[model samples]
Target chain A: MTLKKKQLIECQSLWKIFGQKAKTAMQAVKERNLTKEQVHNEFDCIVGVQNATFSVDEGEIFCIMGLSGSGKSTLIRHINRLIEPTSGEIFIDGENINNLNQTELREIRSSKIGMVFQNMALLPHKNVRENVAFALELRGIDKKSRDKVANETLETVELSGWGDRYPDELSGGMQQRVGLARAIAANPQILLMDEPFSALDPLIRRQLQDQFIELSQIMHKTTIFITHDLDEAIRIGQRIAIMKDGMLVQIGEPEDIVTDPVDDYVAKFVSGISNLHLVTAGKIMQSIAEYEASAGPVKEESLLKAKLDDDLDCLIDLSIKTDEPILIESESKIVGIVSKKTLLAGIQGHWNT
Target chain B: MADEVKFSILDPFSAIDIGIADWADGIKEWATNNREAIQPVKNYLNDVIIWMNDVLQALPPLITIACIAIISLQFAGKKVTGIVVICLVAIGFLDPRAWDLTMTTLSIVVTSVLISAIIGLPLGILAGKSDRFEQLIRPILDTMQTIPAFVYLVPVVMLVGIGNVSGVLVTIVFALPPLVRLTSLGIRQVNPSIVEAAKAFGASPSQILCKVELPLSAPSIMAGLNQTIMLALSMVVIASMIAVKGLGNEVLRAMGRLDAGKAIVGGAGIVLLAIVLDRITESFGLSKREKGVRHWWESGPIGLFYNQYKKLN
Candidate 1:
C-alpha cells in the first residue's frame, strides 16, 4: 500500500457548495466542521462535492460509484475544472488545476483530458465522422488527417463504415461507441466518463464494459469513470471510490469495497453484489508458509491449481469437482491455498487474507 | 383619395374608436420638422430598396421562374416545385403585367426578410443566452405581433415616407418578431448536455454559439425565418397603400372597386408566393428530422440529394 504509483490526478479536500452563498457556506463548513445536512439547514445551500479526496494513478481506471445525487459525477468534473471547487486544490500531474487560468484549463480539457457523458452528447447535426473528428478539428487538425484518425478511432471502437451517418441515424449503442470514439480520437492522456453507458440496456452496457476494459489496456489512458452501477465499477475499475451525499465513503479495490466496506451505506450498496465474481482467491487465501507448515504441502504437481487473481466463482467451481483444497499461484509461484471453508467464509464476507 | 374619408371602423367587442389618424398626422408633422436628422437613414433605406428592385427587375421572368422552380425542387421537392410552377405560370399567362408585379412583391419580401434576419437573429441569440434579455424582448415581440399592422404603418410612413423604401421598412418591422422569437426558442431548446459537452471539449463561448448552439438551433431559427417571410408577404397589400407597387397594389385597387375576380387572382398570387417560401425554408428546418429516417423522400428533395451526394463522394 505504501508503494505509491505516479499520480496523474490528485484532488485534496475538494468542496463544491452549489448556492448563491456557496463561498461563504464552504468557508463556514471548513471553519466549524459542519456536516452536509448541517450546512444545508444553516445556509440554505446544497453541497455538490464535500471534502472529497482521491488520487488516480497513471493508466488506472478509477471509478466513482454512487446513486443519482451522490456527487460522484460532480467530483470527477473538478479534475478538468468543469465544476470549479469552492475550496481545496486539484493537481493534474503535480500542477494545481485550480490555480490555472482559463486558457490553461481549456488546454487541459482539449489536449490532456477527454470526457464522455451518460447522455452520449454527440451533436445531432454532425455526422459520425464529423462528430468523432470534432475534438481534432477544434485543435485545428486538418480535415483529411483528422478524418483518417476519426475513421481509425471509429474502427477501434468497432464502428467502421458508419462515419457518413448522423447520430440520429445510429442506434443508441452505436451512438455510445461514437461518443467513446470522439473522446479517444484526440488521444488524450486522461478520460472522464460520467455514466457513459448507464442509459443503455444491460446487455449492451455489459458488452461496452468488456470492450472498454480491453480498450483501457491498449490505450493505457488514466480514466476517471463515474457510475451508479456497482457491477460496471467492479468490471472496469482498478480502484473504486464510493460517494454518498457528496462525500467519499470509501475508496478501495472492488474486493475491498465489497468485502470490507468502511460504513453501513457502502455495505448496503454492495450487499446485492455477489462476491463470487468480484472476490479473488488471493484476497481470501491462507499464506503459503502457514499452509505448508500446517498441512504439509510438499507436492510439486497439484490436481486443482488456481491463479491468485481468480475470482471466487472459479475457485468454487474448482472446489465442487474435488475434495482437495485449491492451490493459489501468483506469477507461476505458489503463493497461498484456499480451502472450501475459506471459500464459504469469503462468500459471507468474513474471510480476511 | 375619396376613400380616405371612411375612418370609422367599429370593433365587435367595443365601441371605442380604434382609429389613430390624428396620431399619424402628428407623427408626419414631427417627421417633416426632423427631416434633416433622418435624411441619411431614409437615403440608405431607399438605396437598399432600389437595389433589390433593380436586381429582381434585371432577371428575365422565365429565368427567375426557372430558378425558383429548381431551388424549390431541390429543397421542398417535386410537389412544392410543381405547385410553384403552376401558380407562377398561371399568373404569367392570365395577366402579362402580373409577372412584373410578382417580381416587385418578391423583391420587397426578400429585402425585408434579409434585413429582419440580420437584425432579429443576433437579438434572438442574445435573448436565448440571457434570461434578462429574453424577458426584456418578450414584451416587445408581443407588442409588435399584437399591434394592428395598419397602426404601425402610420409611424413607418412618417419616418421613411412612401414607395418601395417605406414598404421594405414596414415589412421588416412586421416580419422581425417571429425570427427573433424562434431563434431564441431554438437556442433555448438546445440540449443542455450538448452545450456542456461543447464546454467540456474546451469550446469558447463564440465557438459554442456558432458550432453547437447555432447549428443545433438552426431548425427553429429557419422556422422563424419562414414565419418572417410569410408575415412580410402579408404586409405587401398594406404596403401598397403607401404607393409601393406590386401584386398588393392590384389587390388593393381590385378590393377598392369590389372587383372579385381580380382580388381573387391577386390573393392567389400571394398564396402561391407564400407556399414557395414556406416549403423551401421548412425543408431546411426539418433536415434534422429527415436525417433520422432512411427513406429517400422522407428528408425532402434537398435531403435526398445531399444523402446521395454523400454516398457518391
Candidate 2:
C-alpha cells in the first residue's frame, strides 16, 4: 500500500545536539566520528538526534518507538519545526521546510500539519469547543464558523456533548479524545502524534488506540506516531522504526522487525512482543521444492492453503484443520510450505527453513 | 601625635567622592525648573480626584451601600455581602463625618489602583516575554518595593508639591511593584506545554499572549491588583503627611490635637473601607468555575430585577 503513494515527509541526515556548543559537537561527530557519550564529555553537548533519516508515504502511519531519552519525541518535533534541527534537511510534500520564513513556516503549521501531544495540553481556560477551534481562531476564522467546525469535529471523536466542558472537568481518556479532536479539527493533511495514548490507563489506552486507528483510516492522514511501547507500534504502525540513544537502529515492517531484528537492541524490544500475529507464513515457510525434496511430493487436494501474508495463528489454524502442511501461495502459484514444526519454531522466534 | 600613634600601614581610601547627593540636588533643580512642564499632569490628576470625589459624595449613602451589597452578593455570596453592609453602616453611625471622609479616601484609592494597573500590566507582560527586559526591571521593581515610601516622598513633594495629586503619585510608586511582579510571575508560571501547543497551532506571539497566556494568568493578575489596591490604601494614609486631604487627614489632625476619640473614629473608618475593598477585589481572583456558573443577569441587582420581571411576565 505504501509503495504506490508519493512521499509526503522526508528527513535527511537530521542531527540535533543540545548545548551551546552544538555546532562544535556536530562538527566533531561528522569529522571525528565522536559517539554520543564522547560528544557529551568533550563538548558538553547531549545528542538529541543523530544522523536520522526516514520518510513517510501519503496516508501511512509510521511509528517511531523507543525508550525515554531515545530522541523519538525530539525526532517528531522536527517535522513541525518546533525544534529546529542542528544540522539536516527536511522536506514536506517536496518542499524544503527549513528554508521557509517564519510566516511561511507558520502557514504550513496552521494549514498543513497538526499535532496531538501526550499530555493532552488543551488550554484549560477555554472550553472543549474553543480549544478544538483554537487553530481556526489563530487563522482569524470567525467564531460562528469555527464553533460549527469544532462541534462537528467533536462528534467525530465521540465527544458530541462535551463541547462546553473545561478540559480539567474531563477524564483522562476524554481529554485525550479532545486533544485528538483539536488536532484533526484543523484538518491538516499531516498528523504528528507524540504518545497521544501513553498517559491513559491500560483499558483507556487500548480504547483510544483503537479509536485513533479507526480515525486515521477514515481520515487518510499521513502520520508520524511516536511511542515507547512495541505492542502499540505493532498494532498501529504500517512500518516501525526502533530508536536508541538518538539513532535509528532499524526501520522495517512490523513483521520484519519481529522476525529479523537488525541488532540486539531491537531483538530485546521484539522479544517481549508476541509474534502470533506479527510473524507471517512467508517469513517462516520453506521453498516448495525444498519441502518436496525433504518429504515426498505434496498432494494439492489434501493440503490446507494459506496466503503468503497470513500470520502464524492463521497458518496454525490451517495446519490444525488438516494433517497436511499448509501451502503458502502468492497469487495462484505455491511459493512455500509451512509445516507444524516450522510453525512451532516460528512462534518460538526461529525462522529456520 | 594621634596620627603618629596610628599603627596601620594604609589610610582609608578617600581620594574622591562620587557626589551622589550633588547629582540628586541637580535632579531636584531640574525638576523644580520643569514644574511648568508638569503642571498639566498635576492639574489633570487634581481634576480627576476632585471629579471622582464629587461623584462619590453626590450619591446618597444608602444608594452607595446598596450598590456595594449587590456587587458583594454577585461575586462573593450572601455572607460577605452582609459583613460589608454592616461595616459601612457602623462607620456611618460611629461618625457622621466619616461618610464624606470615606468617599474622599475611596476616590484616591480607586484612581491610584487604576493608574497602577495601566502602567504595571504592559511592563509586566514585557518582562514576561523577554529575559533581558525582566532582568532590567527586576532591580527597579525591587527598589520600588523595598525602599521606604518616605525616601521617595521627598522628591515627589519637590516635583508635584503637596496635594492629592502628589499623594496619588506616591501611592502609585508604592503600589505598582506587586502588580508588575505578580503579572510577570503569572505569565512565567503558565504551563509550558500549553504554550508549545499554542505555538504548534501557529499562534503568533501577540495572539498567544492575548488568547492563552493572558486568560490563564488572569487569576494571578487579579491577585496582583488586590495587592496593589491594599498597598495604595496604606500609602494614601502616609501620603496625608504631604497635606493630601481625606480620611487620612482626619487621622493626622486628630493625632496633632491628641483627640483620641476622633482618631479612633477615623481609624475605624479606614479599616472598614479596607476590608470592604479587599473582599471585593479578592473575589475577582476566583475562577468562574469555583464561583459557580451563573449568567451575568442572574446575579447582583440586575438579577433581582430580572426575577421580578420574570414573575410579572
Candidate 3:
C-alpha cells in the first residue's frame, strides 16, 4: 500500500566500456555525450552497460529484460561488482560496493549475494551435494555442516536424494535446480539470477518459474532476475526494467509497463505479451465513489463482486454471467468498478490511469 | 670443369653452421667451469636415483611381480592382471637378466614420472591461469617435444654425467612436456561457466583453481600423466646410450652385436612393461572421468574398507 520498503540495491549512472583504453573512451563519452554506436566506431570500444540507473527493493523480484546484447546480464553483474563499472557507483544497503577493497568485495559476494547463471554452472567434478555446498566450502565451513546445509537446500529445490549424483547424471531441469540450490544454500540476502531458466525447454522453464516463485516466497531473498523473455519477466517479476542498447528504457510495475510503455521500444517489446491475464481490476476500474455517483445506485445484494487484484481474464469470466458491472473491493470495502468496457480496454492494453 | 658462381648463396649452407651444437658445447664448457656451483644439484639427483634404484632392486622379483599384479587387478581388473603376470613369468623364464632389466626400467620410469609431475603440475597450473604464460611456453614445449631424444641426452650427460641420474634427467625432459601441456589444456578447457560461477560465489583465485578448475581438469591432467609415463618408457632405450642400464641398454647392446634373439627378448620386456603401466594408469583416468560411479574392483579387496573410506570422505 505504501512505498516504504528499503532499497536493497541501487545503481547510479553505471557504465561499462570494454576495450583497450576504455577509461579514456568513457571520459570522452561522458564529456561530449557520444552515442553508443559513435563510441564503438570512434574508439572501437564496446559499451556493455550505459547510464543504467535503477534500484531494487528488499524482498522484491526486479526483472531486467532485453535482447541478448542489451547489457541486462552485464548490468546485473555490476551489483556484486563481478564486472567493474567504468563510471558510477552501486550501493547495496547504502554501502558503495565499487569503493570496497578486494577482501570486502569478496566478503560481500560470499555472504550477501548468491548468483545463478544461465548455464547452470554446476561443477562437473562435484556431485550435487558438493556443487550446492561450493559456496559454503569456499567459506571454510566444515564438510559435515556444509553438506547438511547443502542437503537441506537440495530438498528445498526438490532435489532430495539426488545429492550423491554428478551434475551430468541429472536432467537439464534437475541440474538447473542444483544450480538454484547452490545459490540458495549459502542463504545470501540477495539472489542474482541471470536467465537461470533460459536454457530449459518451455514446459520445464515454466515449472521452474513456478518453483522459483514458491521458493522466493518461502526464502524472501531479494532478487534481481535477468531475462530476455518478456513473458518470464512479466510472469515472475514484481517490477520490470526493460533495456535497449545498453540503456534502461523503462522501469515500472508489470501492468504499467505492459499497458502504458513510455516509448515505442518498450511498447514494441511488450506488444506481443497479452495483457488479458496481466492487467488487474484495480488498474482499469473507476474509483468506487465516482462510479456510484455517476451510475445509478449500488445494490447491496444482487451485484456481482470482484477483488481489486482480479485480472481482466477473471473479470471477463465474472462479467459473462451478468450484465451488471463488477464491483472491485479491497478488504471487504468497495474501492472501484470494472465494467465490460473497462475489462475489454484492459485486455487490449488501452487502459490507463 | 664447373664454373663456380662468385659468392654462391647455396655454398653458405655447407660453410655456415646454425645448429645447436655450439650452444651444447658452450653449456658443457660453462658447466665444467662452474662445476662447484652445479655439483650440489648433480649430487642430489644422483643420491635420489641411487636410493630409488636400490629400493627397486632390493625387492624380490616375486614380491614386485605380485604387487604389480595386485595393483593391476585393482585398477585394470583381473584380465589385465592375468596378462601382466603371464608376461612377467615369461620374461623370467626367457632370461633372468631381462626380468631385472624390466624392474630397473620401471624404477627409472616411476622416478621420472614423479619428478615430471612435481615440476610440470605447478608450471601447468601457472600456464593455465595466465594466457601469456601459455603463449610464452607453448613454443618452448613444442621445441622440446620435437627435438630428437638424443639431443636431450647431450645436456643431461654434460650436467649430471653418466648414470641413472642422467637417464632419469633425460627421461624427465622428454616426458615433462606432456604433463605440462595437458595440465594447462585441462585447466583451460574447464567449463568457463563453472569457473565464473565459482568466482561469483566469491571463490578466491587459489580456491577457484584448487577446488573448481583443478578438479574439473583432472581427467585431462591424468591423461597428460599417462602420456608422460608412456613417453618416459619410450625414452628408456635412448636414455641407455648414456650408460643408464635397463631393458633399453639390453636392447641397444643386442642390436650392436646383431643378436636377434636377445633383442627380441629385450624388446618384449619393454613392451610388456608398457602395456602394464599403460592399462593401469589409463583405467585410473577412466575411473576419474566417470565423475560419480566407481567400479566394484576399484574399491579394492573386500570393498568394506573402501566403502568406509568413501563414507568418511
Please state the interface RMSD for every predicted structure, separated by commas. 0.8, 0.6, 0.8
Task: Tell me the TM-score of chain B in each candidate.
Answer: 0.83, 0.91, 0.88
Which digits, one per residue and each the tens of the lDDT, describe model 3 over residues A160-208?
A: 9999888778999999999899888889999999999999999999999
lDDT of 3 by residue, B59-172 (tens): 998998888887776666677788888877877777868777887888889989999999999999999889999999999999888899876676667766788888888888
Query: Given candidate 3, what's the lDDT at residue B105?
Result: 86
lDDT of 1 by residue, B68-163 (tens): 887777666677778778877887776767777888888889889888989999999999999999999999989888887787677667766777
Q: What TM-score is obtained by chain A of candidate 2? A: 0.96
- DockQ of every candidate: 0.57, 0.80, 0.71
Query: Between candidates 2 and 3, which one is better according to lDDT?
Result: 2
- Model 2 lDDT tens row, B1-313: 3443443447533434578888888877777777787899899989999999999999999999998888888877788888899999987897878999999999999999999999999999989888999999999999998899888787788888889999999999889999999899899999999999999999888888999899889899999999999998887668899998888888889999999998888888898999998998888888777776634466667788988999999
RMSD of 2: 2.7
**What does candidate 2's lDDT look like per residue over A1-353, in tens digits?**
43477999999999999999999889989999999989999999999999999999999999999999999999999999999999999999999999999899888999899999999999988889999999999999999999999999999999999898989899999999999899999999999999999998999999989998899889999999999999999899999999999999999999889888999989998998899998888889998888889898988877888998898888877777877788889998889888888888899998773
Best by TM-score: 2
Q: Judged by DockQ cut-offs, is candidate 3 incorrect, acceptable, medium or high?
A: medium
Chain A only: TM-score of every candidate? 0.88, 0.96, 0.90
lDDT of 1 by residue, A247-321 (tens): 898999988899888989998989899888888888899986776787786464755899988998999899999
